[model samples]
Target: MDRRRLTARALAELADVTVVSLSQIKTGKQVPQETTVQRIAGALDYPVAFFHGADVDTLPAAAVSFRSLSSVTQRERKAAIAAGGIAYLVADWLHSKYTLPSPKLIDAGAERDPATAARALRQAWGLGEKPISNLIKLLEAKGIRVFSLAENTKNVDAFSCWRNDEPYIFLNTFKTTERSRFDAAHELGHLILHKHGGSNQGPQAESEANSFASSFLMPRADVLSEMPRVQSLQQILRGKKRWGVSAAALTYRLHKIGLITDWQYRNFNIQLRTDYGSSEPDSMQRETSTLWKMVLDDLWDQKLTRADIATGLNIPHGELENLLFGLTAASDRPPLRNDRPALSVV
Candidate 1:
């Protein structure tokens, strides 16, 4: 509640009490009746005695520590951290119920270091030097729900949230195709690499995710061969179809791999910005979630959907609707009945 910025006066109104009474309670000047306390607790969605406690349970102790220096600005960094923290809390709390399917996430356990993470993921998908043909289909196959966010943001792009142990990534469909692909891959990096290990948001973490996406989407072994001939914008534009990565991502990849000179990278970026790329990803204009396609066949195989999900958990349809959509709330969970397939929650 405190981290969420619920003030005393606001709490009073939520509790249906006078500001004076609220202040009295805050200052320890008066003891509120049991009924009043209950109302306050209900309105605040917290335990009845929470207001008087020094340490609130809503915010975790680990989250209370001071933050590190950010890769972006302090202000934007703070917002990003809050966004991650909120999502993590929501994801954790919501996962307690219902068996969640283990996503086709490749665990880089033996190769836990960064160098191995990329290849581990690539090999896990049977992607031997294969260029990613489509971001939408690839992610959908891995149990990632793709949605287009209406709001446009700067210094920040796409993001994924795990609610009810289900991973959903939202792309800012407003961005150009080139940028959109980068954002999608970046979000996938979040899911694969950072979703678990207490990773925080900021320019630095964002950079880490971005780099992973670039490497994951276009492996150096496969794409570096053409770096010498990638001088003209036409070369990159043509390469975009096969890679499903933006010109920017490819250009950055070239720079990272030392294929293109720093000056060349900067110049090409200028050209890309001037052209502004082309249309958004096919579904971006419509702004819909496409995750249902790839995993549906699997879910059907396992007999899981709204009906099966509700039946397994003993929750109602109306409640299931809320769980499926955002109308109501439910917990996130790891696969409950392991009698079937694979998945994980972090």
Candidate 2:
């Protein structure tokens, strides 16, 4: 239901029932008959048992790092949370069969400064000041379970949480590649810096995440050395590609570091807003889940398919397909190596 972004009204229409009747059945106010259950299962492409599964659990909005919450609607947030639930279930199942990397993030929530926390995380992860070639791969290698959200909603950028003491990130692949990277870094900040957990609002959680993302992507020393005397929008746009970040994000970082004066920053913002708006002039290839790809290959070698896994989980095959996106291994390709370094927690 979340994957398709089907509201009660829409789902009721698809199930050939009235909105009130469907709502009553969903709310447990009335029990659905066998025929009605079959109709709903068919409409949702889910087995009747899936709805009854005790394993069906969802992460709340408060438990996640949600970007642009004001711009996001409640319905969109609910849909994203529900989608995350499906991904979490699939990941939990995969973990039981595969020796996946352990969580590598340390508790950096006590640090008041975002840049300090970012640097600390870099040191702990042994990532120095060098640019991360692929943020998704780096996170996966470090034991962060990344998944793409097919919620079909543009308002949600990305979200992260700690499930079963392991970090999980969900990105909305519908956005531009640059935005997606920033979203990935932002969620990483939440995972590392907000270890204790708090509301997304208050005490500048969003700002801290933004700061951590900027500093993490472009370290202070490296970015300072790269900054030119006369900063221009085009130069920033071109330079942003190296760090896999958006022009606006780089510009803000530059401004925060005092590399660019207020006058120059304001002028650059005017040009960037008028010309680029939300679209990135130059974009990189979309990053998919490395861990998921490897897992799918391992499972495929055993002659098990997504349909088999779906049956084991009591979910529809399409749900698993949507959760995996492009991470599923192709039958024509050989299995991936399982020799990647295993990250550890504590």
State the lDDT of candidate 1 residue by residue for 1-346, as single tens digits. 2323466678788889988998887678989998988887787554454344443113232322112233234444344334343334323333453233357876443225543577778888888878766666677667665544333345445566554456666555456665677677777666666556555366655666667777777887878765556678778776665677666667777888887788888998888777775432222222122333223323555555545544443323333332222212222222335433343323
Worst 10 residues of 2 by lDDT: 337-346
Give the alpha-carbon lDDT of every model. 0.55, 0.79
The lDDT of model 1 is 0.55
Candidate maximizing lDDT: 2
Clashes of 1: 9
Q: Give the Å shift of residue 50 in candidate 1.
A: 24
TM-score for model 1? 0.54
Quote the RMSD, in angstroms, for model 1.
Answer: 8.7
Candidate 2 has an lDDT of 0.79
The alpha-carbon deviation from the true structure for residue 142 of candidate 2, after best TM-score superposition, in angstroms, is: 1.7
Model 2 spans > 4 angstroms off: 1-4, 7-13, 16-31, 274-277, 329-346
